[model samples]
Target: MVLQRPAAPDFVKRVFTAEEPDLVWAGDMTEIVTEEGRLYLATVIDLFSRRLLGYPMGARHDADLVVAALNMAAATRGGDVRGGIFHSDRLNSPSTRPGSSPGPAAGWASPSPWAGSARASTTPSARRSTAY
Candidate 1:
């Protein structure tokens, strides 16, 4: 069964501000159509650099996929993710729910903005984004 948590108090409005790298991160999941089938890709990006910190793909779009991505991000940072703020769209997915995450040990506080930018900030590579 899906877990639930009380309504969260948003710490971030529309601002995606961060003082330093690893201070704040944004994550999102999207379905990608491959030749074989569909894959759910969960990615965590460091807002400061707009670099993809972690990305994990799974057949199921469930909490496990999100957790795997989060774990990878933490590992990339040497497991010192304390005081980091993870922002994402507050979809009613099992992965995005409060108290359902396994990242509290790292002291990461995930705040879901009313709306969030799933795409990374404009970068040289971002120009390749397709309109279709």
Candidate 2:
């Protein structure tokens, strides 16, 4: 059977930093091994503050996990994140789409993740510390 794909998102990309909060957010998923099993961690970080806006963990790295993190980020900001952008590397991932997919509502813009921010340290200490 062929699986149907959702329409591409409409959000456009801009220079990485925003003048204020909520303008742009980046989402990423990582996996960790534990005695219990493999745990997937989905995270949403606010670009302006480099703050860990939201994160949700689950056994699988799927739409549900990322959506939960989006929901948490939205809820953290009072749930009115209509004009904000949510960037992610997984452009085709179901979690990056809205509506039929398991991500935030269409109100959010999904742009390809910014490379600069991805490599830079969000923590001041990490940025300042010397690397051996």
lDDT values of the candidates?
Answer: 0.58, 0.57
lDDT of 1 by residue, 59-99 (tens): 86655565566667777777666566667665576554554
Q: Any idea what lDDT model 1 has?
A: 0.58
TM-score of each: 0.67, 0.65
Tens-place lDDT digits, model 2, residues 48-120: 9989877878876666665577667776776666566666664444443334343333344322232212221
Error of 1 at 82 (Å): 0.6
Worst 10 residues of 1 by lDDT: 123-132
Instruction: List the candidate 1 regions with Cα displacement exceeding 4 Å.
Output: 1-6, 93-132
